[model samples]
Structures are given as C-alpha cells and as structure tokens.
Target chain A: MGASLLVLMIPILYRIIMGPTGFDRILGVNVIGTKTAVILVIIGTLFDRVDMFVDFAIAYALLNFVGAIVVSRYFNRTVPLQEMEKPKPRRRAKV
Target chain B: MKRTAFILVLLIGLLLAWAARDFPAWGDPHSPASSSAVSSHFIANTGVDTEVPNMVTAVLADYRGFDTMFETVVVFIAGLAVFSILRGGPNRRTRDREFVVDFEPDLIVTNTVRLIVPVIQIFALYVLAHGHVSPGGGFQGGVAMGASFILIALSWDLKTALARFPIERCFTVAALGIVIYAGIGLLSMFLGGEFLDYAHLAKVFPVSPEMARYHAMLGVEIGVGFTVTAIMFALYAGLSTDGRMRDGL
Candidate 1:
C-alpha cells in the first residue's frame, strides 16, 4: 500500500517541479498532501498503531484542505489586471 | 548569480544528506530519546500518575502544564500582534485609487461547503474530546474547527463567515480560552497546591487526585482549542484583507 502511494506521488512531484502554471503546481501540491495523509495511515497500519496515527492522518488531511483553500483564495483575489482602470464609454454632445 | 545560488543550494543539500548517515537507523530502540532513562520513567509512570491513556497528552498538558499554558499565551499574543499591525483601516494614501474585488461565490462550491461544514465541525470536536485515547488534541482539533469557518468564507464571502463569527466575538472567545486555562491553575494554587498542579484540583472538586488531573487536562485541552480556533480565524481575517476587513479576499 505504501509503495503504491509513493508511486502515485511521482507524477504529483513532477507537476510540482515543472508545471507551467501556478494553479497546476498548487493542484499538484494538494494531491501530494492528500497522498501523504493516506501514506501516514498506511504506515500506522503497518506498525499496528492505527489508533494513535489516525489522528495525525486526520489533522494532515484537514490542514491540506486549508492550505489549498488559502492558496486558491489568495490567487483568486489578486489577479494582476483586476485593479486596472476600465475604459470609459464615449458620449455624443447634444446638438 | 543564479548559478552561484544553485551551486550553493546543491552543496547544502548534499552536505545535509551526507550528515543523515550518522543519525540512528529507523525505529532504532537504542536511539537517544527511546533509550533515555527519563522516557523509561515517563513510560512506566504516566498511566499511574495521570490515568490518561495517551502518554503525549499526559506529558504535554500535565507534566509540562506551565509550558503548554505559555504556549497558549504565545498563540494569543501572536493573534494580538497581527491585529495590532493589520487591524488599522485601509490606508488613506490609496483611498482615492479605490481597491475593488471581483469575487463571485460559486454555486457548486457554496453547496459543497454547506454539506461539509457541519461534519468538519463535529469531527473537530471529536478530535478535541478524544485526545485522551488517540493522537488528536487541542491544536489539531482547533485548526479543523477554524478550517470549517474558513471554508464558509471561501464558499461565500468574508462578510458571510464574519456574520456568523464576528470580530468582537473572536477577541472575546480568544480571551475567554486563556482565562479558562489560567483560572484552573490559579484555582488549584489557591486550594493549597502549586501552580498548574492538577492533582490537587481534587481539593476543590469531589474526585480522586488522579481523576482530577485527568479531567483538568481535558479542560485545558478545551481551552487551548478555543484560543487556537479564534486565532486561526483572526489570522485569516487580518491577512485576507489589509486588515480593513470591509471587503476581504
């Protein structure tokens, strides 16, 4: 299980390393974060300490979601062209 | 310049990787921490001393109770520090330029948030309460709780989340959490015990000293949870805006 999870992270790591867009990189990071939580649980199962390690998994998952949300919100809020002045409409003078 | 930085980073990374070899092997029973007498003593006695099954919690909230209390205060102070820096309204210099937000809360996202917020909050509480038996505790639980509110903000707007949990309420809740943690310690001290001495809390409450410590730890965890929850949201509030908070990110 852990081996498969590590395999899954390879592509995520690739995207994180060389994704063209910021959003793609963020998505890749989020995927890796999710996989890490699952891996943590898998490790717990292997060690026969699931009860103790499950909490760590839950916390990791929750924090991953929060990180993703924060990044998306921050990026969404600050598009470079957002504050640019809108062009005014042309008007005709009364004859 | 870039090449130099790259080479420097590579050197540092390789040096650190080389240093990793001298570290103990994975799960080495003879590792410094695992083999230490202090750990052996804690392992043998925590259950008897606090009656708390989770050794980490027993040590963190009880044995190092003062440390944890100050840690809570640190979190509170951090929140206040952010407030002090960012709580000022929008700067007058940019008042005429007029910052505008182009956010539109998505329908699908809002529905998903509505579905998930309650479950997240319940799970957070479970984590907080179940810390005695499992690995979950105040910090994790509090962050989860705060995440639910953050999700609400994401799905809707900041105003929507803020309406449910106001700025004033945030400050009040944060202060209340600290008061609860310290009040317990003071109460115990007044009852002829040392500061943060939970076992002697039995002097006031009708329970065995061990049981009193156990229950007191739970109360401490709750207090920590409260402060963390408030601070998490407070940070979001301050950072998401320029602390103007009228129209948050």
Candidate 2:
C-alpha cells in the first residue's frame, strides 16, 4: 500500500516542477508532503518499529500542514507597489 | 540562466549521491557507531540503568541529557532570534484602515478547523506523554501542539488564535518550559545526585530509583514540550505579523 502511495508521488513531483501557476506548485508540494508521511510509516514498518514511526508520521503531517498554510497565506496577499514606496515612521531609533 | 541553475542542481545532486556510498549500510552491526563500546554499553545497560524501554529516549533525555538541555536552549534562542529579527510589532496602520489580506476565511476551512483542533491537541499530548514507550518526544509533540495553533491562525485569522493564546503568554510559557527542565536537574543536584540524574529524584518521591527515573523522564519531556510548543507559536506569531501582532499573513 505504501509502495503504491510512493509511486503516486512521482506524478505529484512532476506537477511541483512543471505546474504553470504558483498555486499549482503549492498544491503539488502539499500532496507530496502528505505522501512523505505515509512513506515514513512504511519505512517504520520495514524496520519493525511501527509504534515509533506512527509518531513520526503524525509529526510530519502536522509540519506539512503548517508549511502549506504558511505558503498559501504568504501568496494570499497582493501588497500594493505604491504602499511599498511609503516609508512608515520609525519608532525604534536611538540617539 | 534557468538551464544553468538546473545543471548546477543536478551536479550537486549527483555529487551528494556519490558521496552516499561511504555511509555505513543501514543497520550494519559492524558500523563504527554500532560497534563502539560506548554504544554497546548503552544497548546493554539502558534498561538496567534507566528502566526505560525506548533507548533513543533514554539516551537522549538521560545519558546525553546535557546535550538535550542545550538543544532545548537552542530552540529557545531560535524563538528569541525570530522575535528580535523579524517582529516589528503590530502595525498601527492596519488598525485605522482595512489591512489587505487577499483572502477571506472560508466557511469550510474554518468549520473543519473547529472540529479538528481538539483532536490535534489531544494527539499532541498523547505523543508527548508516550515518548518513553514510543518514537515521539518533546520536539515532535511540541510541533504538533504548535501546529494546531498555526492551523487556527490559517483557518481563521491570527486574532482568533491569539485570543486563545496571547503574545505575552507565549513568552511566559516558553520560559516556563526551560525552567521545568532545569529545575529537575537542579533538584537532583541538591539531592546528592549529579545534575540531571533521575535516580536522585527517588529520594524526594516515594518510589524506587528506577521508577523515579521513569517519571522524571516524563517530567523532563513535558518541559521540553512546553518550550517547543510556545516557541513554535511565538515564531509563527512573529514571522506572520512582521512583529505587529495585528493583521498577520
């Protein structure tokens, strides 16, 4: 089962590399991130250490989720070029 | 330029791949690390010394405890570094007018988060507590706990997340984590054991030395977890808002 999931990651990798839009790339990365968790579990099973590996899988999935969210939120903004030009007042200056 | 970059990447990749051959094969008993008497002693004695089933946890939190303590300190420093370097405080400008965040909270995402946050937090606790018998420890569990908050921020807004965990509270909690770890070490010292010696804790608690180490390990893990979880959220809060606690990305 994990092997098939890993094989499926090849297509996701292709999308991450070749996706036309940034959103497509993000989606591809997220898919691949999730599959990596599954792969970690499979590796754990191979080592006869599923209990230890399950914790890893859970942590990996959590990190993957946070990474996707951070990326999406970053791109969610369209910062105005005009706003970029205006320097806000600097309050933390020292004499 | 893109082609040149790709070629360089492939070159580096192939170099790394070539270098991988020197690494000892997986689980090779004769590997330098595996064959060392130090590791041999650890493998033979961790159960007897610590009464801990998980060798990794026993070695990490007990034997090389000073290293792990410093590692937690490193994590604490990382949180501080992010705050000092990236945090700009909440932008007052964002208060007067609408801050542009190109997306709105989708109902589906927010609702899903509401349902799953409890489950995630509970699982994080399980992972943190179960480290002795399993693969997890403070770092993994802390990241999981922090990730749930990040998810809340992602699904709703930073404001909503902060309502549950304020910025001041973030720093306080982070400090508390380190103190918990160090306190255990200090207590052991006062009890005539070396610093971080869990066996010393047996004097204070009415338990066998072995059981004292077991429980002390759990306490130390929780301390590490606390620091990590706090730092994780604090880093997010700082980086996301550019230090202005308002209107995060």
Candidate 3:
C-alpha cells in the first residue's frame, strides 16, 4: 500500500519538477506532502504499530501545512509568478 | 563547471552506494552492532535498570545523558549564533528585497491555524511526556511546539508571534532549559552519585531507584523540550526577519 502511494507520487513529483508557475509547484509539493503523511500511516499499519506511526503522520502533516503556508506567505503578491519565466540580462561581476 | 560538478556528485554517490553494499542486512542478529555486548546489555537490561519501555529514550535521557545535554547546548549555540549575527546591525530594510510580503493576514488561514495550534501544542506535550513508553521525546515535542508558534507568525505576522514569545525571553527560556538539565545532574551529584546519575535521585524522591531514573528522564526531557522549543522559534524569527524583528516571511 505504501509502495502504491509512492508510485502515485511520481506524477506529483513530475508536476513539481516541470511546473510552469510557482503556484503549480507549491501545490504539487503540498500534494506530495499530504500523500507522505498517508504513506507514513500505511507504513505504521504494516509495522503493526499504528499508535507510534500515527504520531509521526500527524507531525509530518503539521510540518507540511506550515511549509505550504510559509511559501505562500513569502510569495504574497501575484507579480512574481508573471515575471518568473522572463530571462534577465546577465550582469558581469566586478573584480 | 556544472558538468564537472555533476560528475563529481555522481562519483560520490557511486562510492556511497558501493560502501552501503557492505552493510549488514537489516536487523541481522549476527551484525556487528547487534552482536556487541553494549547493545545486548541495553536491550536486555534497560527495563530492569530504568523501568523505561522505550530503550531509545532510556538510553538517550539516562545511560548516555551527558551526551544529550551537550546536544541541547549545541542547539542553543546554533540559535545564539544566528541571533547574534543577524541582530541589530544597520537595518537592511532600506535595501530592496526580492519579495515583499504584505501585512494583511488572511481570515481563513488565521482562523484555521487558531483552531489547529492548541491541538498541536497538546500533542507536543503528549509526545514529550510519553517518550518513556513510546518513540517521542523532547526534541520532537519541542519542534512541534515551535512549529505552532511559527504557524501563528505565518498566518498573522511576526509581530503577533513576537508579542506572544518575545525575543529576549526566548534566550532566557533557552538558557533556563540548559539550567534545568544541568541542575538535575548536579542534584544527582550532590545526592552522592556522579553527574547525570539519575538513580541517586531515589534518595530524595521517595521512589525506587528505577522509578527515580524513570521520573528523572521525564524531567530531563522536559528541560530539553524547553530549550528546543525556545531555540527553534528564535532561529525562525531571526532568520525570517534577518533579525530585524519586524516584517517577516
């Protein structure tokens, strides 16, 4: 079951890697994070230690939520997404 | 340059994989680590010695406690270094930043976080207090607690979080944590045991020596929780605001 969830994350991983917009990447990462919590729980069930693993899953979920919020907060405006794909002229380093 | 770096990384990765092939199979009884007298002693006697069902916590907070105390100090030092480096230089806010976060807090996010923070904190305490019987301990609990504060900061603003846990007080709490850990150690020493010898606590605590060790482990864990919780939040505050303690990410 955990293996299946990991296999499913491949698409989300690709979305994260090839995402056009920053928001797309963020959403992809969030999806993967949520899936990871589920996977943790599945792993716990396999180990026959649901009680132990559930704590880990909860902590992982909380951290995942906090991470997504931090990223969204950092990119508080919509300007960066529009400008992200544009290439800037390279500046020479001053010696 | 990029190609060279990639090749270098590949070589290192291949070397690491080659090294990993020599490692013993998972949980192999004949593995060097499992066969060692030290590990066998811990496995067989941890319950008898400390009454702790979780050997990892017992080993961490009791048998090898001196090391854990120093680990907490290392965390404290890392926070201190970050705080000192970024704090109170000329304000860098005058310089243009790549991203400027808006001051407005979202109602939905804030409300949701308000609902969630208490649960997270209670769980943190559970993890801290329940370390002896399960997998959690001070470090995990402290991180959870710190994350709750960080969530508040994120949903609202840095100022709101700072208002709840001020910067100066962060250091104080951090130092106090170290003091609590060391104080217990010293008390044990004064009670006729070596430093961090929690068994000696049985003399004053009116419990069996094993139970004394168990309770002392909880005390030590609480101390570690305090330092970690404070330092984690402090590091976040310092790094996020570049130590200005003003507008933060």
Candidate 4:
C-alpha cells in the first residue's frame, strides 16, 4: 500500500518539475505533501506502532500546510508569472 | 565549471556510498553500536535511573544534558546574529522588491489560520509535555509553536504578528529560556551534585531521585521550547522584512 502511494507520487513529481504555471507546481507540491502524510500513517501501521507514527504524520501534515501557505502568500502579489521568470539585470561594479 | 562541479559531487556521492557499505544492517543486534557496553548500559539502566520510558529523551535531557544546553545556546546565538545583521537598515521601497506584495489579507486564509493556530499550539504543548513517553521534545514543540505565529504572519501581515509577539520580547523570551535551563543546572550544583545532575533536584522537591530526574527533564524541555519558539518567530520576522520588522511576507 505504501509502495503504491509512492508510485502515485511520480505523476505529481512530474507536474512539479514540468508545470508551466507556478500555481500548477504549488498545487502539485501540496498534493504530494498530503499524500506523504498518508504514507507516514501507512508506515506506522506496518511497524505496528500506529500511536507513535500518528504524531509524526500530524506534524508532517501541519508543516506541509504551512509550507504551501507560505508559497501561496509569497506569490499573492500583482507581479505576472512571466516577469518572475526573467533574470534581473546586473548593475556594473564600481571601480 | 558546472560539469566539473557535477563530477566532483558525483565522486563525493560515490565515496559516501562506498563508505556506507561498512555500516551494519538496520537493527542488527550484533552491530558495533548495538553490542557496545555503553548502549547496553543505557538500554538497561535508563528506566531504572530516570523512569523515563523514552530513552532518547532521558539521554538528551538527563545523561548528556550539558550538550543540549549548549545546543540551545547555539540556537539563541544564530537568532541573535540574524537579528543584528538584518535589523534597522534603510528600508527598501516597494518598487525595488522582486515581488511587490500589495493586497489585503484574504478572508478565507485568515479565517482558516485563526481556526487552526490554537490547535497547532495545543499540539505543540502536548509534544513538549509528553516527551517522556513519546518521540517529541522541546525543539519539535518550539518549532510548531513558532510556525503558528508564522502562520499568523502569513495569513495577515508581519505587523499583526509582531503586535502579538513583539520583537523585543522575542529576545527576552529567548534569553529567559537559557536562564531557566542553566538555573536548573546551577540549582542542582548548589544542591551538592554536578551541573545538570537532575537527580539532585530531589533535594528541593519532595520526590524520589528518579522522579526528580523525570520532572527536571520536563522543565528543561520547557526552557528549550521557550527559546526555540521565540527564535523561530524572530528569524522569520527578521528575514522577511530584512529587519525593519514591517510589511513582511
């Protein structure tokens, strides 16, 4: 079951790597984060220590949510996605 | 240069992999670490010595407490360095920023955060207090607590978060954490034991030596939690606004 979940994450990984829009990548990452929490629970079940693993899963999920929020908040501004792609012009060094 | 760097990284990775081959299999009883007298002593005596079900916590907060105290100091110093370097500089205009964030806090995000923050905080305290029986302690709890404040900042603005946990108070709280940790150690020393000998805490409290160690670990964890929570928020506040402490991400 854990193996299957990991295999499913490949598509999400592809989206994160290749998605054109920042939002697509963000969503992909969030999806993977949620899946990771499930996988953690599955691992805990396998270990026959559900109580121990549940705490880990909860903490992981919380941090993942916080990370997604931070990213979304960062991109909440008026700047276009394309503008972010362009490299900033370098200023000449003073002699 | 990129090709050379990649080759260098690959070589180092291969070397590390080769080195890792010498390590014993996971959970092997006959492994050097598992068979070592030191580990055997810990595994056998931790329960008898401290009555802490979590040996990791016992080792961290009791057996090698001096190391953990210094670690807390290192965290405090890192926060102080970041604050000192980034704080109170000439403010950059919004136009100069890479991404100009100019918007009101979303009602949905703020409301969700408001609902979740309390739960996260309670969980953090649970992790801190329950370290003796489970796989949690001050650092994890402190980070969770700090993240709650960061969440507040993210959902609203840095100003609102700072208003709740003022920048000056952050450092004060951080310093207070160290004082709490060292004070416990010093108190033990004054009670006729080595520094951080939590067993000596039994003298002041009307508990057995084993119970004293157990309770002192909790107190130590609380001190660590205090430092970590303050520093984590302080780091975010400092880095987000480049230390002007206003208009942060």
Candidate 5:
C-alpha cells in the first residue's frame, strides 16, 4: 500500500512543480503532505512505533496548514496583470 | 488523460486492498487487532483506571485522549478548508451552475432518501452518545451524519438541501468543537497529570475517580463527534453545491 502511494506521489510532485496556476500547485503539495502524514502514521502502527510517528503526524499536520496558508495568502495578495492598465475590454467588461 | 488517471487510481486502490488481504478480518473478536499488546493494555488497565463500559472508547477518549484531541483539530482544518474553498470566490452569491448526475432518480427513491435523512441523523446521535459502550465512536458517527447530508443533497435541489443547515454555521461549530477539546486537554495539563489526564475532572465530578475519568473522556468524545460531524457535513455541502452558493438557499 505504501509503495503504491509512493508511486502516486511522484506525479503529484511533478504537477506541483509544473502546474501553471499557483493555487493548483499549492493544492497538490497540500494533498501530498496530508497523504504523507497518514502513510507515516499507518507505517508507524504497522511497525509498532506508533508513539514517535503520532508526534510526527501532529507536527506534519501543523506544517501542512502553514504551507497551505502561506501559499493561499501569496495567491490572495498577487496583483492582477490587468491592473497594470493594459486594455482588454471584452474580458475587462466581463469582470 | 482522464481515463489514464482513472485507471491508475483504480489499479492502485485495488492493489492496496489486495495487500491488506492478510490483515485480520473485520470485527473478529479474537484477531490480533483485538488481542494485541495495546488492546491488552487497555483491557488490564481500563477496569481499574477508567471503569468505562467500552474498552475501545476508554482507549480513544482517555488513554489516547491526546490523539483524539488532535483528530478534532484535523476535522477543524478540513472544515476550514471546505469553508474557505466555498467562500473564496470574488462574489459571495454567484449563480449556481448546473451539473447533471448520469442516473435519473425515481420519485420513490427520492422520497425514500428524504425520509431516511432524519432517521439516519438520529442513529448517528445514538452512535455518538453510546460510544463508550459500543463498537461505533465519534468518527463512525460523524461519517453517518455526513452520509445523511449526502442523501439529502442527492434527493433534493441544492438550495433545498442547504436550507436544512447553514454551511457557515457548521464551520463555526466545527472550529468551536476543536477549541473545546483542546481547552479540556489544557485544563488537564494545568492540573498536572499530562496533557489529557482526567484526574481533575474526576475531582470535580464527585464520582469514583475511575468513573469520573470515564465521564470526562465521554465529554471529550462528544466534542470530537461534534467537530467531525460538522466538518464532514461541510465537505458534503460544498461538494453538493459546486463552486458557488445556490440561489434562495
């Protein structure tokens, strides 16, 4: 199960790096981190090292929040290209 | 590209299931999952330490209360994510877009779904309340509650479905639930027996120490149920509505 999840993670990582949209990449990373935390805890249970991994899961969960929030804030604050005053009326009027 | 992704996910999901073939069968009383060292620890300690009717609940709400507290936090995060995603658009009241499900629901099916929603919700509450003496716990009960909303959404229009409960209020309840859980933990820590030890609650409840701990643990479990149910319901609400709030909801 872990090995297959590891395989799936590769493309998700690729998308995080290659996605054009900032939020899309952030979403990919956030999901990947969530999966990683669950996988780590599951592995910990399987290996009888749950105590250590539970703490790691807690820390990772917090980190996932920080990373997602930072990315979301960045995207939220990003200036629109159209705000530079280049004119495109059909799109501008649509907005 | 969609087909490839679908097939990949299907293949991986099946492979993972196949890998778990050697795991103990579900609900086997004598399986290693039931008889494991941790389970034995609970069995041995619960009688004298917590006096809880259900050993599993004792483990969840007291012995491993810290984890349960954080689980509530996770539910809070999920709720916040759904709320933020749903409300993130430029306009608060954008027009709802139509998306069709492939299957057509008959009148009988739709009516049945509507009728079952309340019954399922009642059952979820039962599960949450009786967790200390039963197989179901907060997570199971929360999923049940969420499933009730899913049924309502499928049978009714988005507006009608969401009218049953406001999503924003659910988000608030979810956050508040986690805060309450954490507050209890902090309270226990201040009383000085570790993060979630229920000794102080025992003193306040005026019961036998073990029984008092059990009661306190049950309170935490209820808190977990509230957060989890709210968060999951919020997710279902978002998924049912699409990217915007429905009109007249």
Candidate 6:
C-alpha cells in the first residue's frame, strides 16, 4: 500500500519540475511532501526498527509542514510596483 | 508525457511488488521485529520495570525517554517554524472582524462537539496516565487533544476559535514542557542515576526502585503530551489558515 504511494512521487516530482504554472508546481510539491511523510512511517514499519525511524518520520512530518509553509509564504501575494512608491505614514501625536 | 510517466511508475511499482514476494508478512509472530533486541527490552522489562501494563507506552515514555524528550522538542520546533514562516509581523494589521458563530451550525455536530469536548479532555488524561499500562500514550492523547481544537475551528470562525487558545501561548507552553523535562533529567544526574534516571526520585521518596521509575516516566509523559498537543494544534492552525493561499499544506 505504501510503496504505491511513493511511486506516485516520481510523477509528482516530474510535474513540479516541468509544470507551466507556479500553482501546479506548488501543488505538486505539497502532495509529494505529504506522501514522503507517509512513506517514512511505512518504511519504519517495514524495517521493524522503531528507534530512529519513528523519530525520523515525526521529523519528516514537521519538515513537510515547514516546506509547505515556506512555499505558501513565497506566493501568498505579489506587491504591485506602484505600491512601493507610497509615502510613509506619519505617527499620530500622543494626547 | 503524462501517459509515459504513469506507465513508468506502474512498471516500477510492479517491480517493487515482485521483489517484496520474499518479504516477511506484516505482524508475523516470528518476525525479527517481534523477537529483536528492542522488542525484547520491552517484553522483558515491562513486567518488572514499571507497574504499567502497556508495553508500547512503557517503551515510548519510560525506557527510551531520552528519545521521547527530543521527539517533543521536534514537535515544538515544527510549531515555531510554522508560526514564524506564515504569521504576519507584530506591526502588521491584525484580523479585527469578529468571528460570528453560525446560527444554523449543524445541530448534531454542534451538540456533539459541546458534549464531547469534556469527554475527550478526560480521555486524553486517561491516555497520559495509563500510558505505562496501555497502548495509547502521550503522543496519541496529545493528537486527540489537538483534534479537539480542530473541531472547535470547524465549528466557529478561525478568529473567534483561536482567541480562546492563542497560538503564542501554546508555543511557549510547548517549549516550557521540554525545558521542564530536561531540568528533571539534570536533576536525575545529580541524584547519581544516569541523566533522566528516576531511581533518585525513588530514593528521595524512600520508595522502591520500580516505583521511582514509574514516577519518572509519568513526569516525562506529561512533557511529551504538552509539547505534542501544542505543536499539533499549531500545525493545524498554520495549514488551515494559509495552505490555500501560499502553498498546499
């Protein structure tokens, strides 16, 4: 069950690299990260070694989170060139 | 191109499945995992090490507590990373609009959530307390508690829901939990048991060695539960708020 999910990674990575739109690439990366986390858990089960792999899975889950956040933060908004020229606001005088 | 890639992946999957033909069946009684050194440690020590009944919990919170402490830390770091990456700066505008509770919230869900929140909280504590004797432990309970927050989020608007439990305090608590765990470990060293040794606690209490270990395990489980719950909630907050905007979580 887990291996099949990992196999999907190849295609996802391919899309992330070749997709024409930034949105597609971001979606692909997020999907890949989610799958990576599940795969890590399965691999931990596969080897029957709980010590390091479970920790690695937990860590990888976090990494996937961080990756998703960083990617999202990157494309959240694009500042228009005109906005850069706005004058700074003056502080209000204290009563 | 899609077809080509699909076919490639299919072929690879087939090859991998064929190779797995010789692999041991899942949960096989004779599998090395069931018989290995690590499993042996749990099976052997569980009976005498602590009075707790759950072997897996014992392993997670007791014998291998050092690893568990770091695991909580990992969760904390993940929360901080998410908060730092996506949260608006302090000077940036905060969401001012009140999160109005929907009037026609699903009747079953609204009532169920209201009723179940307390039950779930009790269940989490049960899992934490019985970790030594049961299958569920700090991590499982922590996630369960986190799910309660998610339930709250789904019931109400994010702003109103989050106001009840601020993310910043959650992060701080998570960090503090780990610091407390480490402090105990340092205290253990002073008592002349290895770092994180609970034997000293027993000595201080004039209790049996076994009881000391049990007490120590409980302390660590508390930390694990705190950190894991806080971090999981933070991650859920981050993902739900901004995944669609910037990247998919």
TM-score of each: 0.88, 0.84, 0.90, 0.90, 0.57, 0.63
Would you give me the overall lDDT of model 3? 0.89
Clashing pairs in 2: B88-B242, B88-B243, B89-B243, B89-B244, B90-B244, B90-B245
lDDT of 2 by residue, B1-249 (tens): 999999999999999999999999998999999999999999999899888899999999998889999999999999988887764446523434335555578777678778778878989999899899887889888988999998998878888999999988988898898999999999999999999998988887999999999899999999999999999998988987777777777
Candidates' C-alpha lDDT: 0.85, 0.85, 0.89, 0.90, 0.69, 0.69
TM-score of chain A of 1: 0.77
DockQ for all candidate structures vs. native: 0.29, 0.29, 0.28, 0.35, 0.02, 0.03
> What is the iRMSD in Å for candidate 1?
3.5
Candidate 5 lDDT tens digits, B63-154: 77877777778768866777687767677665444433222344774776666667677777877777776556777777677666655555
lDDT of 5: 0.69
Off by over 4 Å in 5: A1-95, B1-39, B86-107, B190-192, B247-249
Tell me how much of the true interface, by contacts, candidate 3 captures.
0.35
Q: Candidates 2 and 4: which is better by DockQ?
A: 4
- Model 1: per-residue lDDT, tens digit, B7-40? 9999999999999999999989999989999999
TM-score of chain B of 4: 0.93
Error of 5 at A28 (Å): 35
Model 4: residue B78 alpha-carbon error in angstroms: 0.6
Clashing residue pairs, backbone N/CA/C < 3 A, model 3: none
Task: Please write out the lDDT profile of model 3 over residues B31-107, one tens digit for every residue.
Answer: 99989999999999999999999999999999899999999999999999999988755764454454344456888
Question: Which segments of model 3 are wrong by more than 4 Å?
Answer: A77-95, B1-5, B88-101
Give the alpha carbon lDDT tens digit for every residue of B1-249 in model 6. Answer: 999999999999999999999888987888877878877877887878787766777676667778988878788888788777777675666544322222334466557667766666676777677667545667877876776665565544355457877777778878877977897788878888888777777757777877877877888878888888888777877865542222122
Interface root mean square deviation for model 2, in Å? 3.7
> Per-candidate interface C-alpha RMSD?
3.5, 3.7, 4.4, 4.0, 15.0, 12.1
Native contacts matched by each model: 0.35, 0.47, 0.35, 0.55, 0.00, 0.00
